[model samples]
Target: MVVLRMTKKLPWLLVFMFGTVTASEFRSPSVAEKGPLRYVFDADKPGSDSSLTMWTAYTSKSANKAFINHGTSVSELTKLFFNESEFRLARAFPNCLVEQAGELYSPLLRTTKFKTRAKYTECSCIMGARWSCPVFEDKGRFVIRATVPLRRVEIERTDQSGVRGGAELQDVLTVQPVAKPSTDTGVTAKQSVAIRADFAEALQQSNHKNPALDFTGKIKVGGHEICTFGSEDTADQNQTDATKCLAVVGVDEGLIPHVPSVTSNVAVVSDKKASGSSYSAVPAAGGGGSGLSYFSDTSGTYANLAEDASKTVADRKTDQDTKARMWLIPFRGNDATQIEGVDTGGTMDNLRILSEQVTENPREWLADRGYKFETTSDVGLGDIDIDVGYEHLLNEKMKAEGYIGVRAPTGRGDEYWSNPYQVRRGNGQHWEARFGGTFAWQPFTWLTAKGDMYYSFALEHTEKRCAAFTGADIKNMGPQVDANVDWQYLVVRLDCNLFHPETQSLSSVFGYELLWKRKDNITFSVANMQTWLGKKYNSTTNAFATDEYALDADVAEKYTNSVGHKVRFETSLRATDYCEMFIGGSYTFAGKNLPREQDIHAGINLTY
Candidate 1:
């Protein structure tokens, strides 16, 4: 048996040695020497499948164009092509084995045949072929083998033009894998638990980290689904639906990290009463709250009048039965009792002249009463005089006072004037005397009234020439009255001159103002005026004449016969607490044919 085995292997060993010797002697052909080769697939073969079953061809003409085909078998036709041919190994044959004959050349020769066990289960077939076989008389036939992956084999073929060319093959063979099977029950359970834990942690973190996240999906816990409330519509639906119960978790600032605690608490208390409070404890008068008193006497103590009266009576009675005493007593008395029963007897003949001189030059007479005198520089023709007088207080409101001064024109005395009748060249001088008493009364808190009345005589003297050039110099005696009323936002005032003209003619003016305050810093006021001239004057006649007389005159062109109407508007702005600015304008419409005139004034006042 050893000898037979060795003998059988001898032929195979000779074949292999001969093949190696030939291969060593042969040289591969150069690529330029080999010609072109092509493989042609028989796509029409019935039930026969090849490994090159689904072949696709692409052309360089256009990207979108291609060709496809599925074949049952393929054959290489190298003899019909040019010389120096080369063949690239394409896909292998299915369900078949391939081998090359001795020393395969450039245009190689190969053969394939299907296995005996390879069966065409459906419309597929296995075939064999041979090439350059030693047993065959001519070139051998080539073969291809294939089997279907599933029940039926379907093949596709494409050409260079992307045109598909194939026929369906029904016969197929199915194969199954020989690996182990798998089960996912444990994996699915683990995945469910992991997902639930992740969702719960995400919810808890989002409540504190990011409060804006909306978690409204249904969560399954313990096999029960709980729906979360998100929107009004979802809440309403949950309320109406019996199968779903909404679960809500509200997030507040307290749930967030690092929120500070409140520092204080608010409480409500009722029926709390102050202790030891009485009506007298409040205040006797205007004691508390503003710290001002209503009945408190802010003016000092009252004076003793009885002592002053006795002193004055004794001083006057010491003078003898002289004519000067007679005049002085009546002038100093209150009424006419002493003046009517004056005894003009005794050594009083020269006394009358002396008294008359003293009355004429009242400065010397006032000097005897402890008054002082001073003079100022000449102001044009007249000198300004200042007399500060204080009286001995005899009562709370009355006093005995006297003044001594003269404000005469500069060139009026005997030295500067050649003739006293000659006119003064400048303004006139005035001689004035003043006497008054002040009284005040306050009947209630926040109410006070004070008044003062004084009799004054002002004598103005001017030479006839100066008077003609600079109006007139007449004596004007008058009493001026002023009253002020203050009531919060409303303020009123009255000022009148009882004797305005030397003829005792009275010219009075009364004005009432209404204020409308729109803001704390702005105020507006309107005022009405009722003014009348007691007597009318005519400019046409150049004398005191009525308007009717001036209108009837032959030359009435220079006269104005009508009264004027004036309207004013004022506005003020408080820029600061101590500074204010105001603008006011007035318009006056005069007689017929006269234009409406206007006057505007603006000013700013600052107080420190």
Candidate 2:
């Protein structure tokens, strides 16, 4: 029995000497050669193929606060209304200019019903009628209060007396006319006419009284008139009343006028309709010209309606900064009642989100509509880990170990349709138990030095999470519970190794871990049941609390507590006497709330 052969010396232990090779093993050895006691198996390689570009998150511990790449938060957009002045919306229905005929006792047709103020130079469409009126420049003026939908026609009257309220049977009623733009009207004429002026009654209603004309000049575009009404002013030569002298000439120089300017025409003969002409226009007014032409005289199609009203008053003063409008409804209130939680009755009518106006920075307009942060990933079988340790050498240069494990629960969980930086493959279905210890030494002939510790426990079970409510709640938004989660953790490592001599089969270890997690006592395993918008009403158990959101304590203070600190590096090789292969990567540079992640792995261990 005098036979022993050795090779493949130490790549984290797998030494088996059998027959031949001897020369006293080339002497110079003493206590440093048998510290692996065997029984380690690994496998790995189901997920990560490493090529990441951007994705990081750490809830808090301040590395300048990481939520890295594609982050967004202004409390997730939904606020909906604040008004620090100037936010006049209006336009749910007014602006009918005509269409309502039935009862006419003529108190002026009983005060004719429909006219909230009409005056135009350009919301065009004459013979074929289609008038819209949208001109907004509020605050610095030029406000055309919109809501127009005109174009209904009918006319005729012979009258017959009836119903004891004077000749009343003329019936037909629906006249929506505001026409003038000939050439068989296909209507495409607009040369500035944004009315809403009161320059002290526009020079006492000018019809060109011309005392040397000068309703304060400006009003050109095609027919040249920086202040016309002169050349002996022929019947008030027309630039259609320069929209009431541009409301007293304020659109400086960049004159704005070309034609079609009726500026208010309220005329009524009602039994239902008949208006061959009507008048009450003041600026540049003077029309009895038979059949809709309140004012006309062209050669203008706006070369500068004051540079489009100074670019709409600098885009309405940059969209008036923030009249403050919000409606961020992640559902739960205003009837979806979680006791009216998302800022009192939220309702964007189901978030079709058509800009109820945030103007800018509503998280950059919801990150240009894609709403940012979504870089998912996933792969199979992950939370397995099944240790059964028991190594014990204690000399040849030290060694010791002890293990007990379970882990199972096959991985992957919490996938309410992903997106929350998606990337799940395990640990969420948690089932752990673990319990560890390691100690290695091998003081030299090629280094070694280890120390490890572990603890997991976690058992609870019920699963299906996602409902943080607020803590920068990364939008998983409401509903999805089962609870009873336990999550406790604690790890610790410290290693170094670097062999490679006569097939120490290439080594290299290097490590440093220290994880720590505990804060996810999440309960609701049955507490008050759970309904979320239906049964609610638990004024501290005053009756009605089958649970409409009551796992309480602000959701157990939103489960926090985290800590990390990885930094590993591997590189093994052995390849034969019981196999061994490895590949490395780890790097959670620091800790807190966790997920700094920097993966990359590759494995195979098998050393029974």
Candidate 3:
């Protein structure tokens, strides 16, 4: 598994109100608040844009899951297979005994309603063969069928010796039930019982060939094939219709050359330091504001402006403004001067506003300005991604793999954060379907290159979001309104490595990664907003009523599509047969609507 993270050490203030509400006057808090009539500050800046790259880098780390041609890990030596709970053995011939043992679980198996092996146990075979028998009692045979529940059973052909007939079998088999299995003889849905090795032979012959063989069969869903299943003839050692056994998606044994079985477990940890500066969108040249600034100020005075433009009595305004503002007294300007009708005292840093309300500064009240997350460090698990697939070694110099995965929204999403600046540990808690491929090449003894490309299709979900009045709720102290959001992401990465001759286990790896995210489409009901605003102001339901809701096209347009490119360098040391350590740093050199940030990370890889 791969993990990513970021920090939220805010350095700027954003207390502006949304839309047209005038509470109090103060300087703009961010460039997003630079112009008049633009009240809703892009509060999602810190948690969005370029900062999102950290989560995507997990795809780069997934390269480790690719299949290598050479045998190196324990998964290549020992394989694990599960049984189809309803598989059976009928017509017990005299000689054979089958034994299944292992403790393994697969998400695919769970989805198929197939029983998974939970422990190692030697159970009796239908043939009355002795338990733990090293030898057979009689020279007879039995055909395995899927008509009965053998539950959590898998057959490992301990002997590579071809059955006493003209056929061979792969080492591992997933016995799945067949419809109307024949009890009279070696027949399952009319499939011949004689062990067939065509699939296995092709798998073995394709080892050193170019354009590696394709032995996987299609797995269809809703009339579309979305994944593949191994075709290693598992029905009583006879080739079962691959399309029929969707639960047996993987036949780990014999998939990769010289690897007896395939199973891998990995753990990763990444650290991202808080950044004081971030790249931000600036008004285009000649399009308005000054040239772009690589950094944006996140702190400053904020104003809550409210207006009832059409409300008047004999051309005189009669609207009461209830917008409360937070004054940053310590950060006042140096040019302190007294106003004509208002008494301003002391230096600017120690100044005070003498209004009838005379409320204390934001610092005095624990949450007077706006709500903020606790500054203390928070640690927790991130979203969980389960990937399953197959890889084929094309030749001595290259290999390729295809896979599909699902991301579980188990981590904290935007709604869980106290403010927009706080880091959201998950991708909005939206289930995602991810598919990708990895290709690798090793042309020389000291050089290797690998590339990975993947796309994530985020499902739309309904969640609560900040619906502040005006833009005053910049600190996220607004009403929570249900919003439906949809997201999609695309990523590609390439890595080149140079190995040391003296220490083949050490290598210098350089990589470039790219990510593109489609702008999110967030939709909310205008009626919901009208109800909230009508209840609060009592007479402005008409003002809040509109065809385009506050968070509709306008707010969505502000974020646009985002793109980022990052380059990194790292040194990897294979310290032991089962362990490797790496340390690296990355710099995102260019992109739009992305944070131009740098990060350093270190982690270990353990294989068994």
How high is the CA lDDT of each candidate model? 0.19, 0.30, 0.30
Residues 260-313 of candidate 2 have per-residue lDDT tens digits of 223322110001111222111121323342322223212221222111113343
- For candidate 1, give the lDDT: 0.19
Error of 1 at 575 (Å): 18
By the TM-score metric, which is better: model 1 or model 3? 3
Error of 2 at 538 (Å): 21
Better of 1 and 3 by lDDT: 3
Structural similarity to truth (TM-score) of each candidate: 0.14, 0.22, 0.40
The alpha-carbon RMSD values of the candidates against the true structure, listed in the order shown, are: 72.0, 31.4, 41.0
| Error of model 3, residue 422, in angstroms | 3.7
Q: 190-276, model 3: which lDDT tens digit per residue?
A: 111111111211111111211111112231222222222123221111112222111111111122111101111100000111133
Report residue 125 deviation for candidate 3 (angstroms).
45
